[model samples]
Target: MGELFQEAILVSILAATVRIMTPLLFAAIGELVTQRAGIWNMGVEGTMLMGAFVAYIVVTAADSLVGAVLAALLAGALMGLLVAFMTVTLRVDHFVTGLGLNLLASGLTLFWFRSYIAGRPQPTFDGFENVALPGLSDIPYLGEILFTQRGLTYFAVLAVPLVWYFLYRTKYGLEVRCLGENPKALDVKGVNVAARQYCAVVFGSVMTGLGGGFLMLGFSDRFLAEVTAGRGWLAIVAIIAGNWMPKGVLLAVLVFAFLEALATHVQVIGVAVPHQVFLALPYLASILLMMGFKVRAGQPAALGVPYRRA
Candidate 1:
């Protein structure tokens, strides 16, 4: 009985870790692609928050999961478009543009949320449920840990390899990488540098939006202000700590997710330590991870530098 109970706890923790990883993975990997194309978007937190907010509204008002997802995507795309315009066209500092977006999103979402629920009970919806894959979900321990998960969780896991292939194997991928290294070279070859950066930024924001939607629909029944709770910041940290590689990002995300999962479970298991300590573990780990990782070899040389034609 004792052995079985311990095993169950282990499985539960691992499963939670995988689930928690979904949102962070989406945001981190997406940002990895954006950074590789020379744009350092700092508005991930706002983009994600907007996605989550739009999703919650659509889901509750229309009661349509599909609509909610689409709304989140649209919201993200809009944010991306603004980022591209400011950074690529207006030549605003990338950091400034991103931070401005974050502030706008924060203030805008809070006001909208307040108006949304005014004189009404907070809206709620049935979030995603686990989908247990047949044959795979039946396997002993691994099945419980890996096979039974929200559908988006599976997709998030697949995105890592898919993104890796896109970055390392495709022709366009090489051009995108070149944008980070030498946009002038691409321009000499007649490739449009600003256009490529626009596409990259939009793509990253779209994915981050999807991640935000997943974070909301998969984990919570209703929306709250700042619902992302700094996961966006953590995603940025993961990109830096992972050396901007997909595999490294995956490992980094797993560690952070595991810490978060441990925190969630610690409350259930009734550990004597303050719950706040467990809650702080992932952020604390982020600081340690950043301090420990010194490698910047994979970083794009021209990243965050506004492109100009000679």
Candidate 2:
């Protein structure tokens, strides 16, 4: 009986882990893609907040999941353009620019939610629903954790390989890295470094936006102030912890998710620890992971520093 109970608890933890990790996976992928293009965008959290707001607003307006997703992407792209324009084009400090952007996102969302939709009715919208495969979901212990999840979860999984190909397999990928390392060298090689940087940053923004949208539509039903929470910042840490690789990012997200799940379990089982301390476990672990083995060495040379055009 004790063994059976342990198995059940394990399964439950796995389920919770998957749920928490999905958003982190999405945000980490966004940061990874942006970094591969040679910009360390720490504004992922802010972009995520905007995306969440976009999703909530759009879903409330159009009452469509697709619409909500598209809106979030558009918002992300716009924000990406702003970042690229300031950091890549204007040659501003990437760190300062990113921080400013995050603050902007938070302020804007909070302001809009307060000014426009105070005391509004329940947002009428449907979100990404769990998809259960036939044979896969039939598995005894693992099925519930792996197979029964929203469709967006599959997208997050698929993004890993697709991102790898974009960064490693394609010619454009080479230019992005080149631009990050030495834009002057790429410029001499006749590569449009600015354009490449712009594209990479935008792509990252779009992914972050989608992740934020997913939070609203697939993860939660309603919009709360700062609904994106701190997943964006967590993703940035995951990016460093993942060693700037797509697979690494995925693994980091999984670890974070697992920690969150464990923390949740501890709280539920009345572990006698302060709930806030348990909640802080995943973040603490991420810090340790980033500090221990996966030090922030793989970061782009041009990260957080604006590139100057020669």
Candidate 3:
């Protein structure tokens, strides 16, 4: 028990928590924006998987991280466009549209993978390197835990404030918020509700894709099918558990990440528990968090509803 509380082990857990939280934070912020705009996109998991697959492909072929990330962003945006078309332009049920997209992404990526890399050894690429902040990385425990991390980790952390400012302080954000509560009012006032919704969904999808790309580039040396490993679902859960607030979402992500990190290191700490119990820690923690923080308020009223302008 005392060994588990050692300073070095504690710092390692903190650092691992940050790394695990990065992808979730990116996806949660994007989902938060989409929900605020009154669109319930359940295909987040599939979209993330697509982005991971695309990043792997580009990186394997071109060996360019920039190209890989851009490709992922484009793929995610295209998926968002598809969702917007089905739910906004065609008035299809949002859930059906999202489910269909997930299925399509899953099938398409699998088919491409089997066709291209069939019987071939899995391709590997150099992932993003950690960048140490000048002067900050030198600080005792806090600095090493927070300052020395991958570039995407920093971006994910910075995005929290940027998203909050955009959602609260900007006119576009005001409209987005209104769209979720009463899009009819915006339509009556001559604001293009569908257009705004489209923009919001696409923006969210782009961010989700960036998250997937980071997972592939920063977390793993080689790509595997289903590389996202349910992080997308966890992202959605974080948004709900956080009551749709950015700071709350950040905290939720941290909680989940901490559990995941602890799970990873449980065996190393010489705990007497079974390894399987340690492995399930993250999911168990997620369920507990969701159960504890019931979403009784703050959800968009029109979420998951297809809007039909009269």
Candidate 4:
């Protein structure tokens, strides 16, 4: 128990917490935009999975990280396009459309993987390496935990403030928020409600895809079925638990990341607890957060409600 609190172990855990926070933060902040536009976008998990699978395929085949990331973004856009079509144009229930998309991505990726690797050893790729910020990374405990990480980790952290500015400071951002709170108001002003929603959904998905791509390139060496595990769902929970504010969402993601990081460290320190218990910590924390965190002041009024002009 004391070993767990050792300086070295503590630093390692905090650094790992930051690393683990990257993907969930990216997805949560991105989805913040989607939900703000009144699109429920239940397909985050599927879209992220698709992005990860695409990234794995492209990296293994081309050995180009840049190309793989781009492919992931494109895949996410396509998934987002489908989501937009169903929810915005066809007026399908957002929840149902998202659920269906998840199923589709899960099955499609599994089938494609099985076919691609028919009788061969599954290929793996070298993922991203840590890039320590020169002066910043030289600082004491904080530097190691915060400044030395994969490039995308920095971006994911910066994105929270950037997203917050976009949502609250930009005129277009106001229009987006309006779409979620009262689409009819925008329609009355001759704003193209559908177009805004489409853009918002696509933007969210593109970021979500990038998050998935990073998960593949930064962490895993080989692809597996459902490689994303439940991180995507955790992203959704972060948004809800954060009450839809970018800052709140960031904090929620950090909490989850910290729990996961703690779990990994527990195993390393030879905790007598069952391994499964450590693995379950983050999910259990999520449930508890949702149960106790009841403030909904930041939730958009019309979230999950589709808009149709009559």
Best-fitting candidate, measured by lDDT?
1
Model 3: residues with Cα > 4 Å off, grouped in runs: 268-270
**Candidate 4, residue 11: CA error in Å?**
0.5
- Candidate 1 lDDT score at position 142: 92
Write candidate 1's Cα lDDT for 1-310 as tens digits: 2332597898999999999999999899998899999999999999999999999999999999999989989999999999999999998999999999999999999999999999989989998889999999999999999999999899999999999999999999999899998999999999989999999999999989998999999999999999999998899999999998999999999999999998888888887789999999999999999889877888899999999997
73-172: candidate 2 lDDT, tens digit per residue: 9998999999889888887778888899999998999998876676966555667878997899989878998888888887888888988898789888
Root-mean-square deviation (CA) per prediction:
1.7, 2.3, 1.4, 0.8
Which number leads on TM-score?
4
Question: How does residue 296 of candidate 1 score in lDDT?
Answer: 88
Counting clashing residue pairs in each candidate, in order, gives 0, 0, 0, 0
Q: How much lDDT does each candidate structure score?
A: 0.93, 0.82, 0.88, 0.92
Global local distance difference test of model 3: 0.88
Better of 3 and 4 by lDDT: 4
lDDT, residue 229, model 1: 94
Who is ahead in TM-score, 1 or 4?
4
